[model samples]
Target: MLSPRRLAATAALLAALTAGVLALLVTAGLITFGAAAVTVAFLVTLAALAFLVLIVRRLDGKAHRIDLRIKKYEAELARTTTALKNIETRLDLLVQAVEDSAARRADDLGAILASLGEDRVNAMARAREVEELRAEVRALARDSV
Candidate 1:
């Protein structure tokens, strides 16, 4: 668990120290120069492989987090879509009720107007009958006199 930068620095220091030791061994005739070179190459390659693995693991972790967020957003979107559909259904019902109520009110108003017209005609007929009766009474009085 060292951070990447710390691990890299440590690897570099170790490599340098290792090369110095190998050079001293070669000068003192304890090891061949080719053997020292091969050893250094192997260590450097191993360190590079370790660094690559760490990078891959970190990227995988970030990708997992992003996937989780995407799933959460998709769920929220689904819920919102369902709620909007419910609202649309309620709105349609309300509009229908208002239209029906308006039609009923118009019908009632038409009936009231028809009733008033009939009342006016009946009043006119009654006035004519009363005038005829008064004229008949006056004629009878004249004949008797």
Candidate 2:
């Protein structure tokens, strides 16, 4: 389909051609000048009306296309928003899981450290008892000698 601007230009050209032909007919004495003038005027008016119709149709088509694009964009935006919300929900769950795991790990570490400290204290007590027995054995041997 021709664009509105192209259609208008075509209509103007046809009108000018019609006027020229009518003027030539008058000059050749084939028709009266007054009749030729009226005919040319009618043709020009028709061309103008056609040009206006083309313009109105083009504008309506443009408006319809714009409306369709707006609806499509709105649907895409809605989908994007929904996807973002889902992602946010998943991220929150993941963060909670990580925090819970860290807490459990800390508890485990504390228990292990407490067990190690108790073992160290027990070892020191055993060492002290062994040293006292050794001193008693040495003193008894010296007295007998």
Candidate 3:
């Protein structure tokens, strides 16, 4: 749970303490200077390794979190793609329906125009017959007079 900086700082502190103790032991004739120097070197190396491991672990954790986020985004993208496809299908169906309705309306309009043309022809014929009857009636009146 400790941050990398805090972990490294703790490791450095511990290494320093160990070096100090070794130096004290050498001064008190408990160990030789050459042996203490070697021991201090070894302790410093261990501390450095510990710091590196902590950094690597922190980076690995961050990579894990980023991987999770990428997976979530991919899932959302897939869902959006599916929704768009569904909308496109519905739009196509609606367009087809409109085309069919327009075709039906056009056919109905053609039928109405044909009926009107027939009615016009019938009216013209009736008007001609009425004119002929009027001329015959005038001729009969003249003959009587």
Scored by TM-score, the top model is 3
Residue range 1-145, candidate 1, lDDT tens digits: 7888898898889888998999999999999989988988898898889889999999998999999999999999999999999999999999999999999999998999888988889888887988898899999999999
Number of backbone collisions per candidate, in order?
A: 0, 0, 0
What's each prediction's TM-score? 0.74, 0.70, 0.84
**Which scores higher on TM-score, 1 or 2?**
1
Q: State in Å the error of residue 111, model 1.
A: 2.8
**Candidates' RMSD to native:** 3.2, 3.5, 2.2
In terms of lDDT, the best-performing candidate is 1
Q: Please identify which of the two predictions, 1 or 3, would achieve the higher lDDT against the true structure.
A: 1
Q: Indicate the residue-level lDDT of 52 in model 1.
A: 91
Candidate 2 lands at a TM-score of 0.70
Q: What TM-score, to 2 decimals, does candidate 1 have?
A: 0.74
